[model samples]
Target: MHLIAIDWGTSSLRGALLDGKGHVLEERSHSRGILTVPAGGFPGLFEELFGDWMRLTGSFCLISGMAGSKQGWVEAPYCPCPSGRVEVANAIVEIEPGRIAIVPGLSDVHDGVPDVMRGEEVQIFGAMSLVGLSDGLFVLPGTHSKWVTVKRGRVTGFRTFMTGEFYALLSQHSILAHTLDAQAPLDEVAFLEGVTQADNGQGLLHNAFGVRTLGLFERMPAGELASYLSGLLIGEELRTQSIHGGDLVLIGSPALTQRYQLALEVSGNTARTLGAEATWAGLHALSAIHIANKARS
Candidate 1:
């Protein structure tokens, strides 16, 4: 049997054609993500992107991320915390009779903070498998960064930070807009300087002003403001998260994860990175569990 996995998010749709063993046989993606699809057009767009793969016999489609949200093709409900692969598999919703299933997101109410993740759970589990870790902190850096805790092979809890989105909003639309160059090359020294500032007890709002002042004073080049802001926001996000200070696995784009690794290192933590293969591995894992469940029934 083969598994066709789709990571359908707000901005893009990623699909993978994987063999029984979870190796990717073929893959494709498109910019027409869930947000771009017209009302009630998910099925049509899905067929357009992955119809060939679905046409094959014995192929099962597994989707994750916002495609399972209230706005998706069909709402796949969320699974609670302390969940493992089996829980996620059991929660899968069959959207297309016996052919297609959507993996459920995970929710946690640890420490009075209500946190939820859609596509990131798949990435976290895949990253855990890639690193061969039964327990640790997993960081997925993006618009909504997720800091997840895995214990005894189950997802214990996690938190979300809007660092990336904040950076975008502040840089592009806020008062510091003129100080940033969207295409500027990263200035490592300036970035580290911002991180150092973040640790000085100045809150983000107070520290953010430094971007404009420094540029105004010709102290830091306007071209390098992006790097400094990146460090400041990322540094603050790391500072607030309650990581126990051990090995942290970062799963995301190479560039973004590398930025996070640098911030973690500055905070006296060790980190490693895994890329898209982990998402594929995760979707494959859940799909395998679902297949087993089907056989049992």
Candidate 2:
């Protein structure tokens, strides 16, 4: 059977039509994420987006990400952690029974606090399928970066970092905002310097103030200072992880993953990168399992 994979995020939406063999026949993307849709508009909007593809014989669909959230079309409650394709597939919430469904997000508890993710789980599984490894450290960088660990294809646990969000706040609203140019590209030298400063034993709060001082002392240009601040924050995020493997998996956009790969290399590590297509691969994989199971039941 063919597959229609939709990754509906908070700010954007992506869909793909994959042939039975998993080759993409067509794809579509839009900025009309769940947040843009008005109350009770998901059903109609979805039909408008892919009503044609759904009409195609043997085509099935799986929706992932925030599209299944409480605020989304219909809440597909999160599946608990230690989940694999089997567990996730089994929990698939049917939006149109046998035709369309929403893949549930994964949830885990850390130190008595609950942590959750939506679309990132599929990417992790897709990375697993693509790289042919079920166990490794998978990092998905974004506004809320995720550090996930998998053992034999099941996600055991993970952590979330507000690194990107912190960057935006510090670069735009903090006391150091005036001292740096937030729009600057990555300045490798200054960026690494900030990365190094993150490990100086002074801690991030203490080290962050140095950005303004450097500006005051004319130690760095505005653009370079921005890169430095970025490196510092990303470096601080990296400091918490125990990265030692050669087969580290970094999944996300090139711009974000590039920064992570650079940071990892500086710490004597390497990683393989995967793009957004991993989302489709993951959804396709899950769709197969889900369809097969449904047939038996």
Candidate 3:
């Protein structure tokens, strides 16, 4: 049987046509980002872009990122924290006329600290499948980074950091943009130095200004300053979050995974990197699980 899996994130909509074994047969991507979706354009945009894929695949499953939240196609209610595979599997929402299933994101409120996640939940499930029933910590680095702790096969707790998005804003639009240029290569030395500073307990707020001053004083090369800034932010997360000796799984794009692995290593945590395709794999796996459950019911 054929299956369709969509990873509709904030900046892009990605779909994959896969076989029963979760191998991708064909893929499609469009610029219909969640932010670009007009007030009433979700259904039409989804139909126009994916309608053909749906026709070709016969029946397909969808798990969206921004689309699953209150701001996307439809709000798939959140699954409370301390969630498991069963909770996620049971929280699927079906959009009519098509056999499309929207996976609900996870949310938690602990000690009056409310945390939320949308798309990374699927990626975590996908990564978990590869690691088996082992207890470990999963780190998905993105615009809004997520650090998740899983025990056995269930997600016990997780934390989110606005590292990527903050970097983009500060480097491109904020006051720091004046001191830094955009098209710059990474400086390994400066990047490692920033990591060391973060590891030593310098909060991100304390260190972000260093990017500007270092450039002004000509202490660091202008072209590689972005990497230094990136390292500083990621390092802060690694130090403050406390991943230490637990098994660490890094997900996201190749560039992000590589940098995060380096940061984790600098912070004394060893991590294994999982490729980008894990998101699609996990989505397909969840779809298969949903099908099996329906059959059993």
What is the C-alpha local distance difference test score of each model?
0.88, 0.91, 0.81
Tens digits of per-residue lDDT, candidate 2, 119-234, equal 99999988899999888999999999999999988999999999999999999999989999998888989988888889888899999999999999998899999989989999
Candidate maximizing lDDT: 2
Task: Please state the error at residue 265 of candidate 1 in Å.
Answer: 1.3
> Which ten contiguous residues of candidate 2 have the minimum total lDDT?
239-248
Error at 229, model 3, angstroms: 1.2
- Which is the winner by lDDT between candidate 2 and candidate 3? 2
Give the candidates in order of lDDT, highest first. Answer: 2, 1, 3
Residue 236's lDDT within candidate 2 is: 95
Candidate 2, residue 165: lDDT: 93
The pairs that clash in candidate 1 are none
Error of 1 at 11 (Å): 1.1
What TM-score goes with each of the models?
0.97, 0.96, 0.94
Expressed as tens digits, the lDDT of each residue in 88-162 for candidate 1 is 989999998679989999999967777889999999878877789888989999999998988898999888899
For residue 270, model 3's alpha carbon misses the true position, in angstroms, by 2.0
The deviation in Å at residue 288 for candidate 2 is: 0.5
| Candidate 3 residue pairs in backbone clash | none
